[model samples]
Target: MGIGEGEPHPAGSGSSSVEVVDVLRRGELVVLGRIPSASNATLVCDVVLDDVELRCVYKPVRGEVPLWDFPDGTLAGREVASYLISDALGWGVIPETVLRDGPVGFGMVQRWVDTPDNTDRPHPSAPSELPDGRVDLVDLCPPGAVPVGYRAVLRAFDSIGEPVVLVHADDPRLQRMAVLDVILNNADRKGGHVLEGLDGGVYGIDHGICLHSEDKLRTVLWGWAGETVPAHLVADLADLARRLESPDDDLRSDLAEHITGDEIDALALRTLVIAETTAMPLPPGHRPIPWPPF
Candidate 1:
């Protein structure tokens, strides 16, 4: 969803990343406005710390709608877990997110990111209808709209029977975020959840339906599907795999508070498999891509 109306909130108010994280973990939250969106109830709010205001997204556990596939009341925790994984990889692909008590109860709060205007921003689930009404670009555009070395990862036709090209498999940020989704077993990585910061950082959000033990991965980021994984990415996965296996690892301990032990085991297994194969595995005959791939 597009950002709510009002002045945009700057993310870095001269506070170090550590200090910002601390505020998200302990500050008092004041509701700014409701961001209307499809799937979940997300709120735009201010985290107050010693009179300084930090904008954030607040997702209360009580606001979560029940899903048949996912365990109830765990979405908020999963969001924080996703952030932890991103930090561990040193990818900074997810905005700083933390779990803390809010006005309603415990929930997930993530630092707000600054994105460009609607017309220029790209969404994973949104398609841009060409003026001719013949083609719809799903997460891509004409050659001129993107930079060189951008791979035409997907090709398809719109409803009006026109051809289209889905490019940008070479975007390093997107590539890393896609790998993060796989490791989390993210079941709903919609196009709209990808946000771009003013500083040029790409951030992935809405990870409520992730980290389940079951194989319910669904996303629009299959441009690199079945491609040989890069060595550096594999090394990151290897590190996560080793950490998940260690009994004394704090990450595992932290994750246990949010997900089932079996789910944690499944996450570890996924990391090991991805590292060993060194390739992005294709979906096992199930519906792989999300509908209306943006």
Candidate 2:
């Protein structure tokens, strides 16, 4: 969880903290403590921020082969991946990379996911025996996905009187969140990508694939294929759209720069769909399942 693996070292680890701009990305850097790579990337620390409490997940200059089958180096889509899940969950779950002081310019800071009460990786011999109806928060899929094995969890939600509308239709808050997520090009919202937090909250992690300026809405939520968007969310979508189009919209511009031109069009289209509550598919040629398939 140290800095300066890639970027020039401004100060050594033992140096007194300096201005985040000079040392961190901005003010409000909460050193939540350091951690090690649990899944992918070489990130070894977790930090929190002011306001949105964006978890700064700094992607260090380290990774292994076989992830996404890249076979070498690291995958380039992690930032967008975290964006998708954070938006879907209606909470801030992005790579702490917003900070500029960390080595590699601060994309994600590792937050420690304490060992679960039941911390056994699913048996390799009988993987499906993870229990068909079990409520294990983290599905034991190889490549991490947070949304894939949601049905079992959804069933538990149903037991608690939560409705089981398609992933996109279950919650209006989630629908609105999706609007923001799509605009951000969050790519890794797979079933295992999401983390059910200790605070009764769901926080999405793994952001190396975020902010890509593309129209990538692949997740299990597409089950509600033709559902209409709710009205309250439509108004919210309008507000966000207006803000994104504004000249002062730093977030939008940041995204527009990273993603593809067609991706920007996809973001605009998704926003319009949410604003109008269009009962249509999320995007043409868009995947219906989150990646890192569970």
| lDDT on C-alpha atoms for all candidate structures | 0.78, 0.42
lDDT of 1 by residue, 1-294 (tens): 223455334346466778889888887798866766556778777787654568788999999999888878989989988888888878888888999889888899999886654334343234444355322212556544544555665567766766766664467788888888999998887666776666777888888989999898987777788988889999999999999999899999988888889999999999899999999978656767666655
Output the TM-score of candidate 2: 0.53
- Model 2 root-mean-square deviation: 10.5
Writing each residue's lDDT as its tens digit, candidate 2 over 1-294 gives 233444233232233223222233443344433334235444433333332222334554344235442223323334443343344333444322332345444343333332233124232122223446544443432222335434222222233555442232244333444444454455555655544444444544554444444445555434334666555555656665675556576655655544444555556566666676645354446454554333
Q: What is the model-wide C-alpha lDDT for candidate 2?
A: 0.42
Q: What is the TM-score of each candidate against the true structure?
A: 0.83, 0.53
Instruction: Please tell me which predicted candidate would have the highest lDDT against the true structure.
Output: 1
Looking at model 1, how many pairs of residues clash? 6
Overall local distance difference test of candidate 1? 0.78
